[model samples]
Target: MDIVFDTQQEAADFYRRMPSSFRQVTGVMLINSRLAVFPQKTADYREFAQLITRYIIEKYEKKWIMFIIEKYYYFTDAEEKVTILNIVAAIFSGEKDDLPHTGTLQDRHETIMASLEGVLKEHNTFSFQSIIRFRLTAYREVLRQYVEIAIDEYKLEQEYQVFVDKLRRIVHAYKPLCEKIEVYDEHPFKLFDEHHRLIRNVQSVRSFYPLLKQWGIEAEPSIILSLIALAPKQVIVYTDRPEHGMMKTLHRVFEERVCFARRTLHLGNGSDYSG
Candidate 1:
């Protein structure tokens, strides 16, 4: 079996990184500036195909992703392109979880491996570039889907940053209604005064509703609205789930004013506070 590369460097790289077991059975040579791998034993063809499949996935996958991004999408800002690429990398590496329309990187690898193995079995010598361009349609489609997901994620991240910036501006401009407030994270979220007395009259929060509406921000959670209305100089939240979405928003908006205590809050009657 023979596998050919377009560039001598790529050929050298594939040959250099070949496992010792495979290296013992294969010989590499340069032909017309292209590298070709020739395995001595015909029985080792399957193993050689598997090795090439892995090499393509591990070394050349990112280059394919870059090609897809550049060919299909146009971004004026270089940084935006870089950001999208980073998101694609995260998704491909399985660092980003629970993606909607894509399989795990391992799944993609297996799919490509199966396709490549099928092609390798039928052909004794093939150009690696031609194989990718003509035979890997399914793999390319998967990559395009990944690029789309990355673009979507990048847009959401940009919108989130804008929202956070607007909230920070609002928080900075608003006067404090109280010196401090205690928040207990619950279904509805419980608010307490500085003395740990439950605050029942959150109707005061309605006054700030119109201000947010004027800025095209509306229908936010009541806890978030109340916190904005109160605009306390300090906010101490008692919750084990500091990574909650609401907590992240509060921390982003309040910056130095928010503190988190990672423990459940128990009221005096031995019942957990419920809002």
Candidate 2:
């Protein structure tokens, strides 16, 4: 069986990296600008296909991904393409730690292996590039879908950064209403003054309402609005779920001004202060 690849360099590299046992059973030689692989034994065809498939996945997957991103999606920005590629890798590896909905990376290896094995079985001589272009339609489509997902994620990330930047500006410029504040991450969310007295009245929140409206920041949760409104110099947040979305937003917006505490906030007399 003979497998022809587009570039002599790739063919030579593949041949050079093959195991000695496999090399003994196969012949690799350059033909013009292309390279051809010849398996001495018919029994080695399956192994050869597997080797080639693995090589493509390991070395050429990123290149193909970039190609798809540029050719189909028209993303010309190098940094943007790189970010999307990283996202694709993360999706494939199932390392999207917080995204459990993106589905598993099952069958990707088996799918490509099966496609290559099929090509090898049907043809004695086939161009690897042609197989990738014409034979791997399903695989390429899957890659396109992954790219779409990555692009969506990238846009969401960009929007989040913008939102965070706006909040950061607001936090940085505003004067602190108090020296310190403690926040309890409960259902309704609670805030306490530096004296550990619960701030129950809406007066402080009301005071910041106009600023929030003026800055077009009314979409944020009330707790975030309250915190930003108060703009405390130091914020101590008590929450067991620090990985929660709201907590992350607080950390991003406040930076060094925010600290997390796992224990609950103990208020004096548990009474609400109108102040």
Candidate 3:
């Protein structure tokens, strides 16, 4: 869903309007994704680890097929949507596997709340210390997700158009998501695109893959999809994978194609593109 805040403050105001709980859930989801990137000894799941390894071997062709199965959803199919709507009330009346994944992130909201409460038995602080301690890891994670998507030029040609199309729709369809404003004792933070650096260096694919795997991250295709959704696919999907990123990838892949048509891309300022 596209949610464009008129201003950074407007976005913060919208987040505040949501039931305080939903925001918390979003925070948890984002945090959990972060943890998945660089697992902690205390939190790592051996089984999940093996799954990830096997997932890598599989070349991640699953494509979230189960999501489609569970959703029984197709964006272009209105009749199927109507069928799901018709069964909404009686969905619970089903046999076993019909249930959803009961992972901690799901079907345990109340229990998680209780667990968080037990851990948060401090001064109800939300102090700078508390914020950093609880949130820095995840905030950095958000940045990393942005980075992973922004670089990796190899996949741009394969995916930029799809992403640009998606972003165009999302940005166009975006509406102000929040209407309620909360009185925050601590000033909220904002996201700035200029804050990110773009990558352009690369010579060959072999050199690129090792560098990418070394980021100590599992670069999922969904990341590619997100890059497509957020920026130009041509900006990513570089023909040669050296050390690159989402935008760099597009530059490599599409710069040639569009450049042929005299549509050269300008990959601008970003962090020091280094290992």
Candidate 4:
């Protein structure tokens, strides 16, 4: 089904509200097609809309034939539109084995041209190239936008991979290098700072930043690995989140050297450390 936008503002508004997923490609195509009546627009939006529409049509030709048919009706001459509809119906009406090979764009295009030629022979007036010329001229901008989106998605994926690799390295760095040894701590420190007490209302990574600063650690993995390397005979963790990832990593690295703190220190409330 097609979503008709009667005004440029309506189409722009719809596009803004659309989700940035594959599903939005259809809306983009519909909006761009409806806005085809407007002129002097940049190529980016047109390229994006047409590229997605072409890809979807290629991948699921049968599923999208009706949609394409509807879109064409709005822009094509009556004779050309009739020829396209007849060609589509004739190609899909036959047995599945008679369908053209769609292994590649060339194959699909050749299949479509062959069908078009066969149908056009009856009228002796329409050519596949003529219809394509109109489409290419009308949707040239869409092709440019398609290229831009592809590049953007590629860059985003690379960034995601880099972040994931960083995390993996941190995990691997803390893994035991040799047989486990008992740690001896000369200075036992908790995750709390000298200025703040544990507030039950807060729950976020930022909440621990001040505490980490007080503990003289810059990174989460740094503190955990540092505590292990310090070889604390007993490292006391005064945290309610005993099952936290950092605590678990510590236990895995230090084995029996890590211990849970039995007392709570309210450094934020001006409480004195008895240790």
Superposed on all Cα atoms, the candidates' RMSDs to the truth, in angstroms, are 3.6, 3.6, 26.9, 20.5
Top-scoring candidate (lDDT): 2
Better model by lDDT: candidate 2 vs candidate 3: 2
Instruction: For each candidate, give its TM-score against the true structure.
Output: 0.84, 0.81, 0.18, 0.25
lDDT of 4 at 243: 82
CA shift at 170, candidate 4, in angstroms?
A: 1.5
Worst ten in a row by lDDT for model 1: 266-275
Cα lDDT listed for each candidate? 0.75, 0.77, 0.30, 0.40
What clash pairs does model 2 have?
Answer: none
Which stretches in model 2 have alpha-carbon errors above 4 Å? 20-47, 97-101, 104-107, 186-188, 206-210, 218-220, 241-244, 264-268
User: In model 3, where do residues sit more than 4 Å from their true spots?
Assistant: 1-16, 20-121, 132-134, 153-155, 158-275
lDDT of 1 by residue, 164-191 (tens): 8887888898788688888888767878
What clash pairs does model 1 have? Answer: none
| Cα lDDT tens digits for candidate 2, 1-275 | 56676777877777776777776656655565454556656577778767877787888688989999999989999999999999989888777635534675335566676677777777777777887777666666677777888888888989888878888999998788789988888877878888878887867667766776676665644687778877799999999999988899999999999999995655456567567
Candidate 3 lDDT by residue in tens digits, 105-159: 2222232233233233332222222322453343233323322222222135235
